[model samples]
Structure formats: structure tokens, C-alpha cells
Target: MDYQSIKNILFKFEPETAHHIAATAFELASFMPPVLNALQKRYLVTSPLLEQDIFGKKFANPLGIAAGFDKNATMTKTLHALGFGYVEVGTVTPKPQTGNPLPRLFRYPRYEALQNAMGFNNDGAEIIKKRLERIYPADFPIGVNIGKNKTTPQAKALEDYRFLIENFKDLADYLVVNISSPNTPNLRDLQNEQFIKDLFIMAKDITSTPILLKIAPDMSPEQAVNLTATAVEAGADGIIATNTSIDYSLLKGAKDFGGISGKVIKDKSFAIFKEIAKELFGKTVLVSVGGIESAEEAYRRIKAGANLLQIYTAFIYGGPKLIADINKGLIEALQKDGYEHISQAVGADIR
Candidate 1:
């Protein structure tokens, strides 16, 4: 059957456990060139309008699988084969850590969202680095998202970010210094002026790869503009508008304290992108991802000043059809607006 039929069965498993089953499927497929090739034939969406040129790299499309989805860098090929133009791997730390506890991933299908306190869980950067020794030749871009270890205090967070970036910089197309996940204690504090300057200055010194700051969606528009400017001035490459939002008024009694992602964070994410875009539109690339699961959301974010975009929640709720569906919708939206190139429409509404 199709992905939806399979997902119906898989939904019975715990969210995290189900995620591994899915990841393992990709892991095995990564080794089978034929299966991967077949998947590409089945799901890949190609259109000149969807191509994006940024960071001196040309992406096949702007839609990417966000970092938390592939914490181990294991699914770049499968994601590419399934038509994602890029994949961000990890919130990997210097050392492997068992993030939070079991059942860390919770599904809110009613809201088409997920709550996770997976606290930077991964097999550590060293192991992930070895896994990619052969998986980096896919047709799309691969971005590595680095995070600090839980035991490491904020004062020493720089070492965690530096070590991982230093190790994986050359192996991937770009890198994200993720200080936004609410699950990580005091991690958001890293977004403050002094820490951002210090961590990024040290990070930029370590590699020439494009470096970005993934901020939380809970911050105000003013905070976003200030932080985006700070990162750019510190010699950073771009901004990933948001990670996961902490707002839960609608789900007030959901009993999960993890950061929220998917449909709930869309407006927050888009508004932040618009605010930052006001000043940094041409100065730095804006990677937007939050509650985006439709073509309208993607097109609107681009018009509001996003150069690239990503998704995780919608991918799960909508299944494998999500990417191609969104891409098709984006093309229709771009043409309807009388735009010849998607790039020409990047920030069409940001005046």
C-alpha cells in the first residue's frame, strides 16, 4: 500500500519508536542504490522554478527535512530520493546522550503537531561523522545542526558547538548552531548577545562553511530582528527563523511540556521571518520552518523574505506526499502571481 496505509499501522507504536522504524527503513535504503533510485523515480519533484541558489550552492528545491527529523544524518539519500532538496542532520552533541526519557516524542494528530524533549539525542558527532563518510554525494544539500551536551554548562557550550562543527564542516554543505530547542536547559540563553557573538565568532573561525542560527519562535519580532542583525554582524551566514515554539494555550492541558512544532508555530515563524527580512533580506539567507505544511504557507513565507524552507510536522501528518504536494502548490502560487522564477518571488510581499 501507500505511505498513509503504512502509517496507519505504524501509528500504533510509540512516537519515538515509530520514528526509528522509519529511520531504519531509510538507513537500509541508503545502502541499496536500486531502492533509493526507485524511490527517487517515485517521489522526486523537479521544476526549474523550485530551484534555489544560496550560499554559493544551488538547491534542487527549497523544501527540506528539518534537523530534528534526521538527528543522525542517516536519511539524506532517502529524503533526497523522496524529493526533499536538502536535509539538516542532528542537534548532535560532542558526546552521545540519551535525550530525556522514553516516550520523548508525542503526537498531537488532532493538531497536526509533535512535542519532543529529545534533548539533543544522537549517537554523537563522531559516530555520525563516520556514518556519512559515504553518504554525502546525494544531489541535494546536507546541513549539520550542532548542539551542546546537557552536562555542559552554558559557559562551556562553545566547545560543544565548535567540536561538532569542526568535525563535520567539510563533510556537509552547511551547518546550524541550534540554540533554540526549549528541551535543552538554558540553551536559549545562548541566543543572547554576548553568547551569540562568542559562539559564532569561534565557530566562523573554525570553518568556512555557511553557519546559521536556529532561534526559538517564542521570541518577539523585535528580538528576532536584533538577533538576526547580531549574527550577521558576527560574520554568520544566515538564520533558520525558528526551531519549535513553546506556546500551548490551545493545548493547555496536553500534559506535555516539550517544545511545540507543526501547524501551531506557523504564524509565529512567518512573522519572525518577516521582521528579520525587513533588514536582512539581501544580507543573509532566511531559512523558515514552522507550521508549514501547505503551498500557501511556503509561498507566503518566501514572499515575507525567506530564501529557503523546511518541514517536519506536516511531513508526518501528510505522509510522503507532502513535499511533492507542497512543491506543486508553490509552482501554481508563483505562476498565479505572475512571477517567472520562484527566486524572483522570494520576498515579493516584503516591501
Candidate 2:
């Protein structure tokens, strides 16, 4: 296999199955050092120009495969081999979860997007923590995204989050508090100022893991500003702007209910990035994701104030080559603007 052939074969299977097969195949390939090296030489772009320092950690490149792709941390090494500078694994809950019923993941090839109500499905934080411990690497930065189980109520959400933090604090490179996924009932409601402050306080006391809050794109500008302020005041290390959008007005006749991601959310993602940039003013790191299918869009987001950029839908549409291409485009974009590094370009477009 070639990329498209493998993609076609995977596409023939159901969406969730294809995801599993791909992840497992990559995990198998990761053991072959020669193969992994060849992939890195071909796909992973390492240039001093692309290096970035955020949240007290240095990234070899600013591109990361956003959370949800590898929910179990089984293929982090392989994904890194495929050119992602970093890999974020799991929306791992405190306990194992079956997630929403079948047909949970739907693909809209026409829109170059996917709508999934996976409901934080994973093998649990303990399992993921053990797997991560077995593959520990000094240089690899693996961020773990933590979520509450479906049975966990809104009232006790903090306890669920703290449980994972306490268990995986030493195992993960950083921690992401994912409260924006549309699949979980009332999950996004935690974005409220009071709730967010309370959650952060709990997270703060448990460990020193850099904590970031992930927010949805459907929020109003006022909501975005308020959330950003709340996170900053609560001592959040960073923010992952504009998670998958629930505003399917664009997909009105196409699909019913689920989070929408891809080109449809590009402008919205950028607008939220800009709003957070203006309000935070480089006080906290911003990881932008949504609608970035090409280098031009990635460059635009970095210029808009994202210290780091992540992709999921684009990886599905563009294949593995997209990663190297975006890094190449980013280097060019930086040169065009007379900047010496990626950090110099952050927030260049915003006044």
C-alpha cells in the first residue's frame, strides 16, 4: 500500500472500524526501526526555523495531531513517525467506557469533515497511563486529554477529572481538560466562569501538569472572551481554541446532530483565535484547531496568534503528506514576513 489504496480499503469499512485498523497497523509498523526512520526522513520536517517553545516546553515543530485520533496512546510513536511534531492521545476518562452506541462516527466526504459522538470512549486513563509508561521517551512530548465518563454527572465532574490527573500526572507530558466535545451530555456547560474556576482550582492543587481548557466554536464572541478571561485567572497554562462546532446550520439538509469540523469552521476558528489573542495578549499559549486543510490556512492561524496548531479533519482529507507540506508552507510564510522563527509570527496579523 499506497496512501490512497489504504484509504479506500479503510473507507470501505465503517468509520470507527477503519480508525481502529489504521491505529493498530501503525502501532505494528512502529516497531520496525528502519521503517520508522525512513518515514521520519521522508515526512517529518525538522528545521530550527519551525521550533517553538510554549508552556515551558520546546516543540521540535509546531504541528501536532489533535486529540481524538489516538484515544488510547497506542500509536503515538507511529504518528510522530508520520510527521506530526507531537501527538495528543485520549479523551481518556477515569473508567473504561463503551461510548455512544454504534454508528457513532459519520463521515461526510463531500464536506471533507466528520461528525462523531464518540462520548469520550477509551480504555480508561489507567490503561493509557500504563501504555504510555512502557513507551516513555525523553524527547517526545505526548499530551494526554482527560475527560469524565458518561455516567459521571455535571455536579461530580471535578472528582472524575482529578482522578485522572492524580494517576497520570507523572506519565503525561501535559494535560488537556476537554470539556467541549458535543457527544457528552452537558459537558460544554462546564465552560461557565464559576464552573471553570472551580475545576481549575481542583486541577491546580493535584499536579503541576500544564493544564489547558478546550472550548467549542459555537460560542458567541462575548462567551469566548469570558471563557478566556476565566481560564487565565484560574491559572490555566493555555487554551485549545474552537473545538469541533455544533452549529450545523451549514449542514442543515446534510446532517442532523453532531460536532462539525473542517472548512466550515475555518473562519469561525480564526475569529475565536483572534478574540482570545486580543484578550489574552500572549499571556497564555493558544493551540488552534479547525478547518486547517492546507498550509495557507495553517499560516493564517499562526499569524492570527496561535502559538501551536493541531489538525484532525485535514489529516483525514489530505493524507500523511499534508503534515510535511504544512511545515514547508509555514517556513515559507515565516520567511516572507521577514521573521526568523515561528514565535515571531504569532499574533502578527492582530493589532
Candidate 3:
């Protein structure tokens, strides 16, 4: 059967359940040589024009599967085979915690979005580190997104982040300080000045791997600037201009504490990116995440100064073919604009 039929069938199950089934199928597929080979032939898109060098590593492409999609680090190989230039894994906490009860993940097909209160439900850092060590490709760059356990007091959150950084540093190409997930209580407070400085200190001491802060789209302009300055002061390597938006105004129905993601937040996400890019202007890297699903959207973000782009909800709706389509579209857009490299287009709109 085709992917559309399969996705429809999976949608019939609870979101998390469907995710589990899909993960299992992918894991099994990764073991089959023929299937794996065929998928690579179909999905992998390579182009010198898409190459990006940052944090001392070269990316095959800018389009990637964002963090929340593979929370447990279990699907990297299949995801890599699907042609994503990179795959971010986690929101992994120091300890495994049952995320907010069932139905924590909700689909809003009407807007091609999702609201999740998954509360960092991941297989603790240690387990994920082992999983990564066992299978992560030697050269593939993996962004390890780490968070605090729900039971951990906000004051002691750094300890949890420390555990993840110290343990996963050897395996992860970069570490994403995931303090902006709206689903976790009081997590966003870490976005403030002192907390950012302190956290970056620990992150810097842990390893030389690039550290990027994931901020919420609802963060105030003042707060964004403060965090940006603090990150720059702390010698941060980059910023992923948004986690998920908590503003339910764009959404029709009500959700308790989950963060919203997808097309509805496109403009807002890019606006935040532009603000951060103002601070990052030739200094630190700016990676944009939110509401990206098409080649044009991807190019828009790039021109807006997002050196790298990521998608979770969009990836869910588009599948493997989507990655190919976006990459192809990105190349066409660059060539049509008379640009030889994607980097030349970065911040073109802002200028």
C-alpha cells in the first residue's frame, strides 16, 4: 500500500501508539538490506549547493527532522536513509519520566499542525546515549536535545542538563539546551539572562561541542534579545529560533499546556528568527524551526537568515518524499536566483 493509505491507517490509532508502530516498522526496515538500499536510492538528495559548514562540520543538506519527532534516539538510521541531512534526538531528561498522560499528542489536520504536551517523555539520557553509541553513524551529525526531568525542581535543572551533556557529548555533534518546551512546567524560565549564562558555562565546561538554545515563539522581544546577548556573551555557537508556540489563539480548539507547531506559526516563527538574526548577524549561527513544509518556505527561512532548517509537524505530514521535493525545490530556487550557494542567500531578505 502507498504511504497515504498507511498514514491514514496509523492515524486511526492514538498518536503516540501510531508513532510506536511506525518506529517499529522503521526499525525492522533498517535491518533489511534491500529495503534500506532502496529507500536510500529514492530519498537521498545530494548537491554541493546545499552543503553547509558550521561548528566545524559539513552538513549534507539543511533540511532535517527536528527533535520531538525522534524523542528516544531510536530511528536515526532509517531517518538518515530517508535523506534528512541531520536528525535531532531527544528532549531527553536525566531520568525517564512518563510524559503527561495518554493523548499528550494531538493532531490538527485542519491546519496541518500538532499540539503536544509530551513533557519530555524520553528514555533517560543514559539509555539514549547507549542507543546512540550502538548505532549512530560515525560521520553523521546528531543534535542531542536535552531537558530537565519533570520532578526536578527548576532551581536544580542545570544538574539534569549537565547529566545529558556530559553523557552524550562524545556521541552528539552538538547539544541543544531544550529549556523552551512549553509542555514542561517552568522550563521557559531558564531562558532568562542569568540562567542562560550559568547553563552555557556548564555546557562550555562539559565539552567543546556546539551548544544551541531553543527558545519559544512567544518569548518577548526584550527577552529574546537578552537571551541572544547572553548566549553570545557565553560564547554559544547558535540559536534554534523557536521550539513551539503556546499561543492557542491561532488554533481553533483548546489545549491545556501543550505547545503549538506547524503552518499557523510560520510567520511568527520567522519573525522571531529575524529578531534573533539581528543579534546573530555575522556572529553565531541561527537555525530556524517551525511551520516549514515546502521548498519555498524553506528558502524563505534561509533568506531570512536561518543557516539551517528543521521540521517536525511538516515532516509528519509530508513523509520521505517531502524531503526530496524540498531539496529539489531549494536547488531550483537558488539556481533561478543566480545564487551559487545557499549561504549567499542567507539574510538576503533582511538586507
lDDT of each: 0.85, 0.85, 0.85
lDDT per residue (tens digit) for residues 290-311 in model 2: 8898889998888888888899
Give me the runs in candidate 2 sitting further than 4 Å from their true place.
none
Candidate 1, 165-281: lDDT as tens digits: 889888888899899999888888888888889877898788899999888888888888898799999988999988887787645445547888888778877778788899899
Candidate 1: where are CA atoms >4 Å away?
Answer: none
TM-score of 3: 0.97
Q: Write the per-residue lDDT of candidate 3 for residues 260-316, one digit (tens) a residue.
A: 899989888888888888777678888998899899999988898888999888877
Clash count, candidate 3: 0
Clashes of 2: 0
TM-score of 2: 0.96
Q: What is the lDDT of candidate 3?
A: 0.85
- Which residue pairs come into collision in candidate 1? 262-291
lDDT value, residue 308 of candidate 3:
91
